[model samples]
Target: MPIPKVQKLFQKTFFGIFSMFGVIGFSTSVLCVYTVDTHLSAEYESNSRDIAKTIADSSVDILLNRDLATLQSLIDQFVEIQGISYIYITDETGTFLAHTFVPGLPEVIRQSDPSNTDTVERNLPGMGDFVEVGSPILAGVGGAVHVGMDTGLVALKIQRAIGQQIYLFSTVFIIGVFAAVWFVNLAAKPLGELLGYAVALAKDGAKAPPSDSLLRRNDEAGQLARLLLHCAGFTDADNKRGVAAPGEAR
Candidate 1:
């Protein structure tokens, strides 16, 4: 048998709801993460620039005097700050005066600009991800201070946010599915009742018709129910008319 109009409507509505939620949830999650990541990136750059400037201001006097102990201690203090991977200071000739690590200076330090600070992400062999910030000390005349900060924590927070979004979206999707099923059943109820009534009439013409509750509704389903009830009565009237016609002709 062909599918009923009510069933078709249910199918279409369910599909539309599911598809719409899927797209909206996915797009919202992606946009939220992207927005957060962008903001975090900007925060990282701003924070690094500020920290580097602070270090530069503090180290300029000691750097000019070539006080290795004070510079080392100063850089060491800043290194203890959370998320700081390493900090170093270099002289006007690009020679490192003090550093938290003994590694050779990166080639970029030679080209460092004092007027403008710079930050870049580096993926080292053992390090997952590190961002290096450079600031010129003494207005580029004294030297420069470079700081590297760990980014794993920021990434972890982003992941946590994404997880929360997933959980929230999943809960909403489940509720929506259940609601769709309920609404479909509610919408199809009148049609179901009409079908049952037609079946009853087919089996036994003497059976009483459906109640007027459905016919009283203002909805399309009520209209259809009213039409079906009218057809049933019309059919009975036609039968009686045929019988009376034969009797009248005789």
Candidate 2:
């Protein structure tokens, strides 16, 4: 069966309005995710660098004096810090002096590349992701303190942030779509009423709604209704004509 005119208008308006909301919600969600992820990653990286630098500063005197016991204790304390993979110190000749791990001390640090004042981010074969920071010890010893921090926590934090954004945006999108559909239907109400008035006039002649109510509206629907009322020309004498055309009824 062919759909009624009012039904067609309602469907078109609801879908058109809802589709616009969907596009807006999707773009907003994507932009929010990108902004949040970038901010979180940068914060994690900065924190990791700061931790590495602090450990280097504390280890300076211990490393220069070759105080193995004190150096070992410091390394163990730093390793207790959350997200620190390991803290190790090397001699001027690149020989491991003390370390947090129980392997005693390796003859050589396989991934050691010490910089004078900065930390470098790198991905090692077995270590996953790591930030390698180095600082020089200046108590008459010519070695550097190296701290390796794990980046798993950074990735984990980013993932959780994105998940939260997904939930938040999904809720907003759903509410927006429903609200858009509702407003569109509300706006179409007068048109639907006008269509009903026209249908009734075609079938029931003088039984249609009074012209005064529609003429009060001042919109296009009101104009159309007024035209229909003019054509019908309801009159007290026309009632005796028993629903015939206006001219014939007169």
Candidate 3:
């Protein structure tokens, strides 16, 4: 069937509104996801820092005593813990004492001077990216321990979950908007026709005949039809009372 002009207009308006709302919702969802991810990453990094500090402090006495076996065991225990990628110890002379990675010291710290106690170095592979945390080992202690944690897998999982949630919500929102638009168009169809009829009657400069179909409705459309019928009745009565037509009377 051919679509009514009113229905077509309603569809166009509905799509325009839907597109605008969809864009806004998508943007807001993306912003929210980014903000949440940033906060989560920061928290994860902070937790990693705390874990690194604990490992450093717990081994301080062991390093001071030059207990190589105890320190190696401690490093082994730490590696066993999940999320920890690599752990290594360096002496005052920058010598590679031991490392969980078994590949010796990272290039970033390998070239640095032993005398410089400025910053600690860290490198973690297979994670989203590398992160560095600084902690100085006292002069008396043999050397500072570097702990590396990989957050790549964790970050990926978080991103995936956020994306899924956005997709689900977008689907629901689209369905809801379309459903509302359909109902609004259905409810407005009759009123729209009545409005067109009124406009036509005004242009024609004549009273409209009352139809049983128009008077049967008990809604706003019905009230409008009744009002129109009353106006037609009054015009006919005036014509019978010797009143001229609208233009003639003026």
Per-model TM-score, in order, reads 0.75, 0.69, 0.66
The CA lDDT of each predicted structure is: 0.71, 0.64, 0.61
Model 3, CA-based lDDT: 0.61
**Predicted candidate 3 versus true structure: per-residue lDDT over 1-250, tens digit per residue:** 1113466656776788778877977787788678767876666556556655666677788877888788888888877766666666777666766667655555655665544433333443322354444344664255666655665645675778678777887798778887877888766766665666566556673354434454556666666755664554546664454433322311
Candidate ranking (TM-score, best to worst): 1, 2, 3
- Candidate scoring better on TM-score of 2 and 3: 2
Residue-level lDDT of model 2, residues 37-124, one tens digit each, is 6776666556656765665677676665768898788778778877778777776666667777544433235544443436677675
At residue 209, candidate 1 shows an lDDT of 44
**Higher TM-score: candidate 1 or 2?**
1
- Per lDDT, the best of the predicted structures is 1
Q: For candidate 3, what is the TM-score?
A: 0.66
Q: Lowest summed-lDDT stretch of 10 residues in model 1? A: 241-250
Clashes of 1: 0
Error of 1 at 138 (Å): 1.2
| Per-residue error (Å), model 2, residue 136 | 2.6
